[model samples]
Target: MKNFIIPAIDLKEGKVVRLFKGDFEKTKVYSSSPEDMAKLFEELGFKRLHVVDLDGSLEGMPLNLPSIRLIRKAFSGSIEVGGGIRSVETCKVLHEEGIEFFVVGTLAVREPRTFERMVELFPERVILAVDSKGGKVAVGGWKEESSTSPQELALKYENIPIWGYLYTNIDRDGTLEGVDTKPYVEFKGYTKKPVLASGGVASLEDVKKLMGIVEGVVVGKAIYEGRINLRELL
Candidate 1:
C-alpha cells in the first residue's frame, strides 16, 4: 500500500490559518490566499490536499465557499474538504464544485442515520471524521465532547460505504510536537477501513513512522511553521 503525504489548508474568514489545539482564539495566520497555498502544494507535487473551513466548523455551516472554490479552481489535484458539512445538500454543492471527498465529523456521530444516508447516496466520497480528545469524540469544531469513542464510532460504520475515517487527536493538533501513534494503531487494529491520521505531525520522520500504517497523514502546522519541508516529503 502507498502512503500519502497530504498538505492542509485551514481557512478562517477567507484566510489560511491553523488553530492551537483546536482553539479558535489561538490561531496562527499563514497565508491570505488559500488559492495560492493550494497552487503551491500542487506545484510541490503533493497528490492530495486537505481543506477545512474553521469558521464553518464553529458556525455549523460552510462559511468559506468562495475560498474553497478558489482553491478548487487553482489546483487540479485531489481535494478533500471538511468543516460544517452537516447535510447532504452541502455535500452535493461541494462535489459539484470539484471536491473529490467529503469529511464529516460531529454529524456522523450525532446522527448516524443521516450520515448513513449520505454514505448510501455518495458511496466512496464520504470520509467519517473521528476527532477525539481523551479517547472520546469531540464535535462542533472541537468545542464539545461527545460520549462516543473513536473506535466505537468506527465500528458503527462497519457496514456502511464510507470512504474511510479521518482520525484527529485534538490535544496534539497545531502543537507541532509528534503524533500519538497509539490511537491510530489501535484504530487500525480494530477496523479494516482506511485511516487518515491528523494532528501533531512535526517532521518528515513522523510521516515516515505513520506511512504504511495509515492510508494518509494530514500535515498542517508543521508545514506552515517550517518544521517539515514539503518538497522533501513529496
Candidate 2:
C-alpha cells in the first residue's frame, strides 16, 4: 500500500453509479449529479479525482467528455478519466479539458499496436487499467474475458514511460466485500510502476492495509455511502 488517494466518482449518464465487479446490469445509482459529488471532493481537500464514463465505455462510443470536463472545472484537484478513451484524438481532447490522467483499458488489451502508439504520443499522461475477474484480464467493460493476467499485460508496457497501472480486481470491485490486496501486492513485486487500485476499498483500515503494497486505491462505493472520509485522506 501507499499514500491513500481520495474518493473516486464513477458516472454513468451524469449519475454516480457503482456496479458489482463491472457488471452494468448490477449497477446502483447513488447520485443524480456527479458534478456535485466531485465539487464536494474538491472542497473537502482531495488532491486527485477518478472519474469514469461507464456508459460510453461499454457501448464503444466516445467518452462522456462533457461530464469529464464539468468535473474538471468543478474540481480544484487533478482529475483522471477512464472508459471509452480508445484513440489518440480522444485522449488529447480529455487532456485539453484539464484532465491530468487518462486510463486506457480495452484499447490497451485489445489493440496493442494502438496502445504502443499512444504510449509514444502521451507517455506519462496515460495509464493502463488492468481490470480482471478471477485473476484473468477482462475487457470491453469487464463483460468479455481475455486470456492474459493483469501482470502479464502490465509487463508489456511496464518499460514504457506511461503514468502507471490502474489495477482493479473485478471480483472485489464495487462489492465492498473488502479489497483484494494480494494481486496488487503481487503486481507491485513484478514492476515498479505506480499502481492505483480500483474497487473493493471499504474503510480507512483498508487504506492503511494497502499502504504496504501500492501507491493509492480508488474508492467508489465506500465514499459515496459515507463509509470513508475524503478530507482526512488528502
Candidate 3:
C-alpha cells in the first residue's frame, strides 16, 4: 500500500493541542475550535484525520464527544479516535458517532481477553497503539509504563484482525527533533500488519524516510508549528 499522512487533532478542554513528549503539563494549544481545524485538514485534501481525546485519556472515557462530533460534522472523511477507549461498548458508541477506527493501547495490555473480544467484534476497525517510551510500552494515557516491550505487545496482537498499528515513540513525540526510523525499522520485523509511524517527524525528509518502511505517519506538532506544509505532501 502507498504510504499516507494523517494529520492529528488532539483535544484537551475542548481545544486542539499538542503535548511535549506526551506530557499534559506541556501542552500547546493550536486551535480553540476543533471543528475548524478538522475543516482545515479536510479542505487541504487529507482523506483521514487522527483525533485523540486528551481529557478522556486520563478520565477513562470519551469526554470530548461534543468537540469530536463537531469535527465529524465538519470533515467528511474517515476519523481514527484514541484516548480512554477502554471497553467494547465505547468502540460501538464511537463507531455510531462516525469514528471509523479505534486506536487502543491500555486495554490491549491490561485486559487481553476484552481486547480480543473487541477485535473480534470490530474486526479490522481496531488500531493497536504500540506506544513506546524508554524501551517499554506506555499505557494509561502515557502516565504508566507497561512491563511488556513494544515488540511483545505488538506480537501479542499479531494474529488478531486489526486495522494496524500506531507505533509512537513517546520520547520523540511533539519534540520537533526529527524522525527516529531505527525503532520503527526494528518494529516492522515482528509483524506484517500495517504500522503507522508517529513522533519526531520534523520535516518532509523525515516523512519521506519513513514512507518506505511504514504504511503511514501521523504528524501533529510539525504541521501546527509551521515546520511542515501540508500542501507539499499532496
Candidate 4:
C-alpha cells in the first residue's frame, strides 16, 4: 500500500531546527532558511508538509506568521501545522490562511472539551498530536506529562471528525537512533483513525516499518542531516 510523505519543519525564532529529547533549550539549527528547505521538498514533489512552530509550541499561539506564510507559499501543497495553537479563534484564522490541517497537542490533552469543540466545528481540519515518553502523552514541548495514555485519547477520538494523530516519541525525536515503533504498536487494536508517525526516522526501512500504523510520517533531522533522501521517499 502507498503511504503519504509528510516532511517536518520545526520553526524556532524563524529558522528550522530539531529538538533533542524534546528539549527546547538545546536545539540544533538545521536550516537557517526554512523557505529554501520547503521549496526543495516541494520541488521533489511531496504532497503535504508537516510544520511545527517550536516557539509557537511554547508560547501557546503562533509566533512565526511570516515564515509560515513563506513555507505555505513555497510548498503550494497541503500544509498541516502543529504548534502554539491554543484556541478555536487561532484555528479559524490559520484555517483561513490556507493551512490544510492543525495539530493540537497540549491543549487536547488538557482540555478535552476544547478539542471536542474544535472537532465539532472544524471536523477533519484538526489533527491531535501525541508526543510521548514511556507511553504517556507529553505536552508543553514534552516538559509536561499528562495522566492520559496515548492510546486512550486516541481511541476516544477514533470516530470523531479529527483528521488523524501525529505520533512522536519525545525521547527519540532528533536522536536519529531510528524511528520509535513501540508507541505505535501500542495503538494497535485501538483506533482505526490514521496515525502520522514522527521523530527519529533515519531511513526508508523505518518508513517501511511504519507503513500500516500511520497515514503518513514526518521526517525532520534525517532529511536535513542527509541520512535519507526526499527524492527516494517521495
| Candidate with maximal lDDT | 3
Minimum summed lDDT over a 10-residue window in model 3 is located at 1-10
lDDT per residue for candidate 2 within 1-234, as digits (tens), equals 112664677888887888877888888999887788888876777778888888878876555677777788888877788888888888888878878888888998888998889889988889898887887888897789999988789888888889998988888888888876788888888788789887788888877788868888888888877788665554
Query: Model 1 over residues 131-221: C-alpha lDDT tens digits?
Result: 9998899999999999999888988887789989899999999998898788899999878889999999998888888987898999999
* Each model's lDDT: 0.90, 0.81, 0.93, 0.83
Candidate 3 global lDDT: 0.93
Return the clash pairs for model 4, or none: none
Q: Pairing residues by index, what is the TM-score of model 1? A: 0.97
The residue pairs found clashing in candidate 1 are: none
State residue 183's C-alpha deviation in candidate 1, in Å: 0.7
Model 4 scores a TM of 0.94
lDDT of 4 by residue, 36-76 (tens): 98899788887889898888888889998788888988888
